[model samples]
Target chain A: MANLPIKTVGVIGTGVIGASWTALFLAKGLQVIVADPAPGAQDKLRSYLEKEWPMMSKVGLGPGASLGNYKFVADINDHLGQVDLVQENGPERLEFKRGLFANLDAKTRDHVILASSSSGLPSSEFVTDCKKNPARVLIGHPFNPPHLVPLVEVVPHPGTGSEYVTAAMEFYRKLGKDPVLVKQEVPGFIANRLQAAVCSEAYSLISRGIISAQDLDKTMTSGVGLRWAFTGPIMTNVLGGGGNFRHMVEHLGPASKVWTEDMRKHEFDASNPQSLNELSNGVEEWVSNIDLESLEKKRDNSMLGLIQEKSKDAA
Target chain B: MANLPIKTVGVIGTGVIGASWTALFLAKGLQVIVADPAPGAQDKLRSYLEKEWPMMSKVGLGPGASLGNYKFVADINDHLGQVDLVQENGPERLEFKRGLFANLDAKTRDHVILASSSSGLPSSEFVTDCKKNPARVLIGHPFNPPHLVPLVEVVPHPGTGSEYVTAAMEFYRKLGKDPVLVKQEVPGFIANRLQAAVCSEAYSLISRGIISAQDLDKTMTSGVGLRWAFTGPIMTNVLGGGGNFRHMVEHLGPASKVWTEDMRKHEFDASNPQSLNELSNGVEEWVSNIDLESLEKKRDNSMLGLIQEKSKDAA
Candidate 1:
């Protein structure tokens, strides 16, 4: 079967991620059908879209793109017949997702791609309950503020058709997103796990009193972060070693190994009160003087400028 | 003794790092005396300073700052008496560093701070041979393109004076550099270790064919890296969980642990021809159609713009 063209996208659960996804799809000239059970989801989503549309326009908007092209419904089933694709952003509970997928599978067209925005859960876990054609089910997780951040992790279940995966990747690419394929199901997918590795080590260092949270953030914002904003770790290694990653490894391997061996491993047990207190106390102390909203605004503006600068002279 | 102000900076070994340091110091209105033994080193250093001066001026130049304020010499001993601080960027070998530190110890003023630009070698390893006040010697490692990148890792040997460490930190701060004080003498320091952790995971994913190098780069440049450029992993976690880092850990800890345990460790051995070939081929293939030079230019320009934007509302 040919891949379905995604001109109208169904967004289930109009929360932050879903709303942002809706805004992005709209900016790409796609009509978005938003479904959420919350009492004021329509108002919330409308305000969000209005707030983000200017920024999206500055970034770029497809021909005839406008917020008026979207529709809001309290029921997902009502919009299933209208959208060519469904983006599920329901609660992360497996049971809830499983039940939702089954209902979505029953109502949506057989060829419509049903993509869950779950961060870590594999689609295979939920699709097993679906009685209808389950080959169209997969995970298309986006980073936060999906309209701005360009990553969309396209993860496919083992039972998912290869063509659907390709189609999903193409769809996201058409929306100006970089979609990375998750060949195998891994917990937290790729980005989250990588983030965890760094986070765990950071927690350990802070707990041990080696550095303050402000300094740690400064360490990144001024150093590794600069390198990462343009390239990945592997390419940075290649550049570090003068176009040879192996050379870098050979020269700096022992030091890196020692550090890795000493890296802290934090077990995230919810029952542990100390861990939570420690992290919270640290963060509050670090942000004592700075207002979070302004800091975040500064960050967003900088990201916007960076994206604009990098896209210039694009081939 | 009070910390001596740094009006003159001596740059040893006028290579890329040294030349960059010279450009930065000169832009900050510090008279820099660059010393290198290599033939035509003066001409090369002069050319580099000339090319970077315009960009440096755009960023900001202190009063009386000019490229002509810098001088070049073929002997380190000649500039020791003239500079208040010496930034060594010699070859990264313990034997050579030991020799250089000893010479610098004997030639420099008793109050002068002798700092190394070594990326991995801790100052303690080489400063042991500095008979005259080894406490004054430490590591002042800068990220690449010292004139542009803001991070400078200031690492102190245990025997180094507490005052010297504080002075070094303040000095770098005055020059508009984010100097992170490495609490302990850890190899690879904080930034590089974090980078290594991420690199190891990325290499593992690529080797397993989960994602291509190009897509991996995109994943970072578009996702995690965007957050990181503004904040560290720890702060990001705190924000991720709505001002609670611990909440994030409790929810995502198990998945993160699984990924960390499964992370790959690549040992860089020059004798291992296979590792070199594999990585080189991978990078070349990812960069096949794209020109590396243009890519790098785009990165640098984006970085400059990001820096400009971030510094606007600086408190």
Candidate 2:
């Protein structure tokens, strides 16, 4: 089963993530069977693909890839058996996921892999509802704008089969995605936890009036973010240590400890209304004068160019 | 003083940071007076510039920029009076900075801005030694490899004058550097604190055996790092919330709080030898089969390409 080719993909719930996944699957020349209950979701997905197709082409499309390669269904249950794998992107609520996965389990073949695009909830929370082949269910979470970005966190539950994990990893890798096998189920997984860590510190700095939102963002885009885009913090630590990880840890670890201690004193508290207001207002002031639509377009275009630039490297 | 155009720069120390600063200054078409006491320091600085000149040229050189525009002096104090702005990258020691800055304060003209590229210590920590015109002394901390990276944290001590702050900002901006004025001196300033936050979380994940060091780095370079390269976290939250930052905070903030709390439990304690070993060994295993020299070259080249791609955007 691990070596079986996944020629068709079932994408349930064609929201933002789902649509992006659909676009990627189509670009990979796979027949994507999409389902969504929301009104106009089909049109929205089509429009999104139309807007994103050129960028996808620039990134290089798969053999036989086409915009008309997918079929939309109002009920995913009707076409569940046709797909080699299932990508569930229903609402993030646990109850919704529990019901959706259970239905998916009942309809799909036992050999079919069931993956969720949940950013927060672990697959274990909902997989228990699947009466058959729960071992195949796992999390295949991608960063936002999945078609453009390459990261896919392939997280498996404790009881998830090793073979299915391999299949999921191979499937995503074959599609040109960088998939990491998460060994444990942690809240927010790896990427989001890392993102939250940065955001928490950023929010703290802004709330303390130490720096404005714009400057904080500039600090990233112009500084660490540029480095992180090419190197992870661990490898960065290794390189910073002059090609010896121990040297870096011994030299810079103490200062980092002090920074972390200072950072812990000001965690972003969602419960505090004032904290939320301050952060919201800070971002508002930063984006108030700018046209968000054009800014977003520019961001997407820049990301596309960066992806091209990065691909030139052997990594 | 704010309106004064800086034609000459005094660069103290010729280590990695100092050399990079010298390269940037020369590339900016400024006559640079560099001083370092280390043996063969002048040769090392010239070699570093020779190797990095091509990348800087690709990023675009300032008018009249030349490799021979710099003069290396054995003692910075001798030519401190010749420069309009002094960028100090001396050893990171309190006593060293105190003594160096005191000499800088006494030798340089009262109007010349004395800027230290110190990463850990604040400007105030050493400025007390500058009895004459301490207001001209401040921290102009740049991220590593300052010649390529754009961020420079322009932090001022309480006694530092606003005109110098304005001068520092204007001077760095003129050289195509993104200078963020840190309103208050905080531990790790802005960029390092944010970086430490992400590193701490990354260390925890790797130490806990939840992910490999390579995957953790891949998670960043392939995921959030891509988005961060273009948009900062605050604006990212704003866009994530559908153009309303308040909405994003209210929605994702709770989950982020949970992640932060979990992250706090596993702070990277430098005192723990076992913890340091775990992180160091993890990174070692990841890089064991890779070539460090080529990787560094690849990273620097990729960064240069990214900078060029980013410069196209209006921001």
Candidate 3:
């Protein structure tokens, strides 16, 4: 295992996720080399960074962090040797990823860690094409707008090097990111699966006319979401049982079965046209009365405040 | 349809939920007549109030709110006629709730809104025993520690009066609570059903050794939970589509189905002894190292901070 510190990061494909990653890397005092063949990608990334910098500054920038520290490279392959680590946010096509990883594997040094920000695709599927040191490549998926939200799922395939896994976890931790190592290659990893679980039930309820989209959102923000912001469901259960896990399961188990049984009957499926239309229409009506741009701003601001509050508690 | 404000509340069964309701009522400047037949229930409730009062004060108490305005009564029946509303927090047994609601129905005036704090049992299940004015009885379920959390599920049965629903919604809204009217009586209501969905997936993942309990919690607290704290799943989907709900569904539909299909296969079933044991043991191991009391205190404090911050944004 190479013990070199990651001082420079290569960001591939400057989409929303990649741009956010670049902004975060820049804020953390790391030199970022960004590359995207798409027209105006550099300008868009710069604009996004400029717009998001104030909030990042409020969260406190790292030592020597600067807006001008990053360079927009024409080709990431040419700059691969200059970066200590690479974060790929390319398109989700399996063939595209396979070819990209193969190229990345050949260009980057064996010591350099290559991480993908793919939300769904696992590294193992694409790494089959990487002939050189595929062991160092893994999924470092972040929640949307990685610059703000702290979750990064550091999922390593069965063949991934344990040292690289540790390095990835430590790398994110040093950047003020909460990185969870998903033990096995699972679809959706941890956060998205949990999110899908909740969303399915939510869609089911909405489709069945048990609740409106607006009211369902209220149910979360006002109640469970408030507690969940700091504590996850399992710990929440533990707390609900008054710090006893056994007691909680024993008390709430039967009720949970009933709810899950009802929930299992429905899911948010695109194949089911009526179900999809019902949920989409409900959300459409809800958003019709909402100024989404302003709401997004408010949500980001609130998220910043919450992250700060939580970090203070952690400290 | 009496237009009288809910000035005074009768609190029956001052256990955890009931006591929390009393604290909120007292903080909202409502006269509370609390009754519990259990030994030392009054002292427990008093201590709980004293401990939680500081947080409530931090969230900014309602007009004329005071800790001393509530009276612990030996019998809530005598005071039911004096109170404008009755918030029952009795045992979960259907027979017990039926008898309690029957007595409350007989004693309280027709205009008095009787709301049960039951988490699972729907009002319709027990309202069959209410001989008089069963229309006024409904579920006013709050998330645990109702004094801090803003969500109140104002669920009314099919037979419940429309006036009572309006009154309950207005009453909670006046107290700065976010109450969502549950249009239909469903088991576990809205929040718990959503909660159960998430927990089932969480339990399944833990049991399958896909992730540790600790990391699962981190995934939530750091990722989806943060967003959920303010915006919910459906609205999140809309935002993901860049303020277009249909776009989000269409774009992410295929992936979401894959996730939900995988998630639907496993559930946290109490009847399946191994599944139950695996989840319980995982949680047990995770909590063993955690100082739950201190964690609970930290969670509550952080929750108070987040709630205060969110309310500021809303303002």
Candidate 4:
């Protein structure tokens, strides 16, 4: 498939991630067609759009963007040949994904790239049954609340054509998203794996009583998080090296080894009642009383301001 | 120390960290006495003060705060019996710190607490030689650019008094800083260790050519970084749990384990030419062309804005 400029996007699921994708696509002035079988899915999607439109406007919508330029269908077949690309946010079960992709493959055009927002499962695990055109299928997983967050991890399977990967990446970039091509299809990809590494240690620390959840959160929100907001660990490491990342490795590598070696692994079984209660109680000590909706609004507003600030010099 | 309100702060060694502390001290309306023997150190400190004053002003200076309230001395003896507390940012050499702290301990009043801005070395490593009032000495290590970043890891040695730790925490909190009392004196402390955990995996991925430094950075700066800027991984994990952290751990814990098991460890030896070249080239590809000064300004400005936003509802 050629690297076609995506003008219309079909959203295969209209839950949180799907609704977010809809908002972003609409903000970017792309025609969006959405389909979901759940009752009131369309109403929920419309409500989400209305609530998020003001924030989207402040974040700066693309030229000619309009909330009215969208279509929602109860049948997946309605999206056939209607969208240039399709974002599948269906249930994460492999069997469900396979069935959906098979039907989508038969229905959509051969060139219409089919991307799944599977966070952990690689596209190959689900796209195996897309006999008609597996080359156009891949994972274009966005971080949660995709409309606001810019990262889209585009992981293509071995059978996926290079052109399709490029097309999906270019499409996300056109929507003012930061699209990273996952060179290898590891489970959870890069972000979640990295998050797991840090979080495992965080869990161990909390469980061992070395620190409180509030302090751990403060350590990041006030300390390294500021740096990570703009520069990743690698770039920060480079600067830590005086612009030579190797120097940092030489000096800090042993220290890193020591920490990583001392790092603890935490495994909490869902079926274990004791472990669940302990973890739940600990979280309550820190954030149980927080008004989550208000906090989310604050977070979203702050994120919007920061995003606008970063995009100031963009061409 | 009875959590004595710190009024005058003596800053030893005026490098970037010391200068930043000086700026923050002045901004907080504390009388600052700085001592550094290096030639042109005073000029650099003055320049840093002048350069940072506007930003600090924007960040909000306390009543009676002024650059004029600061005094510079070439001799450490000048700070004797002069300031209520001391923040040492001396060279990261054990012998130098030992000798300097011994003199500082003997010269300053026993009631005054001494806090070192050492990034990795614990207070026990150097305070052993302080003959007088070593119990008042501890590490109050700040993140880079101490004035801008709010986190200060207050680590105390075994011999240090609990009251001194409490005093130090109270002092930093009074300055509008986030003081996390590190119960253990481990190398690199919590934030850096957590950072090392993530960076270790990042390095292995880059070294193995699974991903480029740029995409790896985008994965954080665009995805997890946003969450981290407001909520640390622990709180984020708790939120991920549907307000029941245990639930998240139960459901996502297995997934985290899978990722952690797949994680790789990296140790880069500076003497290894291949390691140095590989790491350096990877970072250069991402950040080589960017103007460092302007980039730093952008980062600092964004940080200032975010800090202000976060502080809006503070009691």
Name the runs in model 1 displaced over 4 angstroms.
A264-279, B264-278, B288-290
Worst 10 residues of 2 chain B by lDDT: B306-315
Q: Write the per-residue lDDT of candidate 4 for residues B1-315, one digit (tens) a residue.
A: 547677889999998899999999999999998889899999999998999999899878999999998989867696679789999998998999989899999999898999999987888989877888999999999988788889999999989999999999999988889999888677678898789878877776776677788999988888888778987887677556656666677778778767877774343334567766776687778788987777777777878788888888453
Better of 1 and 3 by lDDT: 3
Report the C-alpha lDDT of model 4 over A1-315, residue by residue, as the tens digit.
547668888898998889999998899998988898998998999999999999889877998799998999767686677789999898888899989999999988899999999898898888878878999999999987688888899999989999998888889988888899888788678899889877777766665556677887888899888779887888777666667666678787666666666664333334556655654566678887887767767777777677777777454
DockQ score for candidate 1? 0.60
DockQ comparisons of all candidates to the true complex: 0.60, 0.84, 0.83, 0.64
**Residue A269 CA error for candidate 4 (Å)?**
9.5
lDDT of 2 by residue, A6-97 (tens): 88899998888999999899998999999898989888888989988997897779998999999988877788888899998989999999
Mind giving the per-residue lDDT tens digits that candidate 2 earns over B172-229?
A: 9999998998998888999999888888788878888899999999998998987898
- In terms of lDDT, model 2 sits at 0.87
Worst 10 residues of 3 chain B by lDDT: B262-271
lDDT of 3 by residue, B249-275 (tens): 777777988887777665556678898
Clashes of each: 0, 0, 0, 0
lDDT of 1: 0.80
Candidate 1 per-residue C-alpha lDDT over B1-315 given as tens digits, one digit per residue, 9 for 90 to 100: 428678999989888899989988989999988888898898898888888788898768998898899888766676688889999999999999999999999998888998999998999899878888999898998998687788999999889898899999999989888899887787677787778777767766665566777777777888898778887787676666766555677777666666666563332333456654665567678755665666665666667777767767575
TM-score order of candidates, top first: 3, 2, 4, 1
Angstrom error of the Cα, residue A270, model 4: value is: 9.2
Assess the local accuracy of residue A26 in candidate 1 as a C-alpha lDDT between 0 and 100.
93
List clashing residue pairs in candidate 2.
Answer: none
